[model samples]
Target: MQKTKLKALTKILGQTALIALITFVMSEITLRIYNKINPSFVFYDSSYNRFRGKPNAPDYDFKLNSQGFKDVEFTVEKPAETYRILGIGDSFTYGVVPYQYNYLTVLEEKLNKSGQKTEVINMGIPGMGPRDYLSILVNEGLKLNPDRVVLSFYIGNDFLDNYMTANLRTEEKSYMIALIKSMIKIQSNYKGKVLNPTTVQYNDNLPTFTDEKYLEDTINKSNMFVRNPADGMFKGFVDDAVKDLIKIKQICDSQNIPLTIVIIPDEVQVNSQLQKQVKQAFDPNNQNLLDFEISNRLLTEQLQQANIDYLDLLPDFKATAQKTPLYKPNDTHWNIAGNRLAAELITQHLTAKNQP
Candidate 1:
């Protein structure tokens, strides 16, 4: 009786293993074919110590160029009448919306419409900061021989992002894993877009965003207001950001190229009501703990000292934020309106610069 029972158990186990194997293979095959049709996932690049979009992949439906950047294929030689501006930064510069809706694209159209031929090559990548910017500038930006450079600096969590770039980890190369990650990221992004799902968190030690949309990513993006326990660093993050920019300045200076900065403010800074909510969350007794201008003012001072030209969008954004929804409902990025506003403002700035 015992031998018969053992034989039956062994058969059951073998059948279960076979079923799991078949399911995995089928799923893998399906994913492979699906990816071929619509390839849009980022892969870890050991050489650059960053995640680059797959060549020719339509990442976020914004088709990447041959070089993996979300811009048109650029020639090393500049056209005689065409002026090229190389735009670089983190996600803000990468843009969440489609390529057509991106501010850089709008800026280019505006420039060209105004009778000056221009091309804005976007070198933005999501989850990147100062360290990554430096590497990209050295490796790729200079090679294109751009006439000008425009850097987008987001005040929200760029300082934190800058400091955290030190902690880089190698992601496992797995198709299934990459697919799941892409799905989760896209789903989370859509959930808050045009909707306010990312409510403020009260925990002082925890990251500001407690919503499921940003929970997985919150640990890394600590803004000026919140002091994430894991990092045990915030103020220094500001200094480190400026430090990196100074280095970028030195490089541009050596080449005799001009660099301009566009300061992108955090949503909390623009949304007055959100300010109250975050204040209450952190410390109701001291509602003024979160100062919106702290990050901007600090960075502004450094840029001025370095003689760097900048266009701070915070004032204009705050002025019209209540009148219109400049940012996505709960997300940190600029909505369509905000992007348009940025393009218009940049148009005024650039046109004025070329006036003389």
Candidate 2:
């Protein structure tokens, strides 16, 4: 009886080992095959939550094809006598479609025409908010010793960006690799959807996030989407934001360089009249929108109290959004025209401040 029991136990252990080996082999094969088919992690989807599909998702540095600043690239650092402007923000700052008039490029051209001896570096990354910009300021930007650091703080998502998704672990290459891997998984599940969603043509030509529908959803969900634990005014995010602001202040003060914070308007805060249209389109029930008044008051009050110099662009952005759609239809990023407007506004402010 003892001999029979021992034999049974051995047989059970062998089967378990065999199963483990098969599982490992399958996972390896899947991972490899997946990488082969889907090169980019980004995919297209029509789901409201995921307007643009990102199944396997690229790393933070993955440059999408529609990026606005694709035509613009930075060269090696030049001498200090040459004025350099480092522009930082999320995708808006990094134009979605390649262009000559992307705000950064626009500013550079304008500054050059005036002979300001300036080079504007587009340091914008998609999905980054204040924290990511702050990180770039310290880690990557300061080394160049920019004459002026223009921080374009997008009111809509930067608040959330400050609290969450601040620090990312992967570098650009590893991120691209992971994105490729994710694409493979998506292809496995994909039926007939095109690889690029935004590439498709649409007639409405409405801006993706700025519409009334988006603002309503944003207002309702704002509370649910904090960038960090201290996203509220009196808490950690406020303190962190202040600290980040101060750090930039200190850098400028030390270098005797001017610092400007360009407060980029979120589509939600463009005002009730404009927001109503979006509400009508997406949620006639108006179930998802937030109270713009309360949010605007809180944000404005904080910056004012901090004594930070900011150019609130809501009034102007609202007018522009009303006249022409500033956002792309398939993606949550500003189109070239929107970028041009932003740059023009910033230049006007700067030129006004510098006037003799």
Per-model TM-score, in order, reads 0.74, 0.64
**Candidate that would win on lDDT:** 1
Error of 1 at 34 (Å): 16
Lowest lDDT 10-mer window, candidate 1? 195-204
| Model 1 global lDDT (CA atoms, 0 to 1) | 0.73
Candidate 1 runs further than 4 Å off: 1-49, 59-62, 168-223, 226-232
In order, what lDDT does every prediction score?
A: 0.73, 0.59
Model 1: clashing residue pairs? none
TM-score of 1: 0.74
Lowest lDDT 10-mer window, candidate 2?
Answer: 44-53
Please name the candidate that would achieve the greatest TM-score relative to the true structure.
Answer: 1
